[model samples]
Target: MRFVPLSSRLLPGYGTLVLAITLVGIGVSITRPYLSLFGTDVVHMSAAELGLFMCVNGIGGILASTWLGRLSDLRVAKKYIMLVAAACSALGYGSFLVIHSYLPLLIVSTVLLGLGASAFPQLFAYARETASRVPDVDATFATSSLRSFFSLAWVIGPLLGSYLLQAYHFSGLFAATAFLFVAVLAIVFWRIERRPPAGILGSQPVKSFAVLQNRHVVTACVSYVAVYTASSMNGLYMPLFVTKALHGSDRMVGSVVALSAGLEIPIILGLGALSARLGKRPLLLFGSLCGALYYVGAWFAQRPWEMLALQLFCATFIAISVSIGMSYMQDFLPDAPGSATALYSNTNNLGQMLGSLLGGAIAQWAGYREVYLVCAVLAATSWLFLLRGKRFKAQEQKALRAALTSQDIETTQTRRAANGD
Candidate 1:
């Protein structure tokens, strides 16, 4: 037998895949902080309108991800799909430079780049295919590690955006993000090698809406949505919580948010190893519980230092919960990893959109403190879903084993009967 080298045993185009995802992450992060700022300052849109824009964008992503994920599984050209997505994002974001009206920007933000955000689903599908081709690779871990790279981008993108906004205003940030997307498209086109079609990744054709029928998957998706919502709403309101409630400054909010991001690094690095040893369910449940506790603590925080400490605690739990949830989703839908991932991704986006809207509304009606309490309730409620998830997983494993055992017994009986025993 001819021996294959270790490098050859690795996934094809893995390097390019990582680079593409990292650039996408950076591109999004580069403009994230300025989205709200742009709506308020440049477009002169109200908070409700901004929230609706986010919701529509999220809904667009939800539609695109499921359809595109199915397309990728059907062996469509992944590089071409990525190129289209990146190109659309670039054009949409670039157009913002010339269009000053709220309606045009809203349409661009919600329909155009929002649809392009579907690229992540296809990107994940591509990663799954590449990882599947390689020997001795854990696709779950590879995917998790790929996602952690986004956090690294998160660390730098927002800080850069904030600085650029200080210097050149909202147009500068939008233009910069457009340039980043163009760079992403260029790098992916240059690096990825196209492959011939393999059969559809799944055993049968899957309808886009059919995925929602899986109860455990639905529970997991909803739990994830809740977790992400808490994170997004907190990010939006934390500045106010620190400044008005705790008597702090922009510098103080920056320090706390930075600390939160810093704390996630170690958690992300260690999560896979921990999951291997401790198993996915325990980690998921523990992380969810911890998230609930963190929000509860945040509600009680009275000083800037206390808020900072609470946020650090929250980041660790969020990292663990998200990593575990993602791994769990892949495990449950092993045959359709892309679709599973897309569902989780959509749930996360939906959560963030709803959280921002709801949190803003609560803050406006009652106060920041009430908003914190609501997030606490939401996080805690997520744990209930996890409890049911544990039972569902157990039943599934048992049924699978029982079916296998029955098949084995039937095969043995048939052999003996054929031998005239």
Candidate 2:
């Protein structure tokens, strides 16, 4: 049960890589809440438009993530890709200052922010490659821990966004995000190392469409999409549900959101350790089941406190599902960890987009209760998928072991024949 620390003897470039990731987290957090707020307050858009804009963002992420992941594997310059992405994001955020219309905002923001999504996959690939070069480090665990820092940013980012909105409005928030991206660009240019030679850093071109052929990879991606949808459905609509259905005040809703975000940290840290010990499949199934149960719990709650309590449970379940599912995906595709991580990450973005749009529509037509009920169903469905995924992963592992064993026996026979033993 000993936890492995990332090796201290990392290449100088790794430090810049971490810094780049931190800045990206900060940049995104700065603008996260403002996107919806801008659509509502500034552009006077409806809930549906807000949902669509968010979906647009996800579409951008999906396109960028897949391409950037492949590019990272091809030993492209991480710093160069990240710097351009950060600059594009900064431009996108800056454009919001003058963009009062929906269409322009959508196109500009997606192009800018969507490209920004490229940063994380590139950084993840860099981290995995760097860790592999170090003799003592476990790259998978290091990547997991490194990714956890984004959740930590989520805890702080929303609070900062809330305060910034209160003080300076949407423009201020976007401007702040722009500044963060500029800082990211500066740091990457100044500090990041040049791309290492291919194979030296475990960087190699991914065979075309090979990741899609892997059953475990596909299962993990699908499971993640479902789990993310379930989680984001609650996040996107729970505040409105609390305010409208339960007669909760804005203060109360904010408290619920804050509590959920704050609670995720411990849940993530604990679940990370638990996933390693108990294995990923059990945690994935259990987490999804608990998530479904939490939504059902929310449906029956009449009081504000009851809803708040359910939010905490929902957050806990999501933390378990995401942390474990991501680790599971990485373990399955250890050879191309970047693709695995990118696929998992993109599923999250897609899930959020779909969940937000669907949740908003359900809340609009069927009522908030129906939204929770639908979420519960989605979560429960994920359990079935995870069960199937578990079986597939076990079979894949067994087959791999058998292959390795045969290879070893063949090597032994060849050695014996050569020595006439």
**Evaluated with TM-score, which candidate comes out highest?**
1
Scored by CA lDDT, what does every candidate get?
A: 0.71, 0.71
Determine which window of 10 residues in candidate 1 has minimal summed lDDT. 197-206
List clashing residue pairs in candidate 1: none
For model 1, state the Cα shift of residue 285 in Å: 1.6
Clashes of each: 0, 0
lDDT of 1 by residue, 1-421 (tens): 2443445434667777777877787778767645665666777766566666666677777777766666655566667777888988898888778887977777776667765786666677667767767777766566667667766677767777766777877778788889888988898788876654333433432333454566766777777888878877787777667777788875576566666666776787677667776777677778777787788888888888987777666777777766667767656545455666677777777887788788767766787778778888888777787778654455784554354445545766899999998
Candidate 1 global Cα RMSD? 7.4
- Measured against the true structure, the TM-scores of the candidates, in listed sequence, are 0.84, 0.83
Report the C-alpha lDDT of model 2 over 36-80, residue by residue, as the tens digit: 556777898777777777777788888887776656555566667
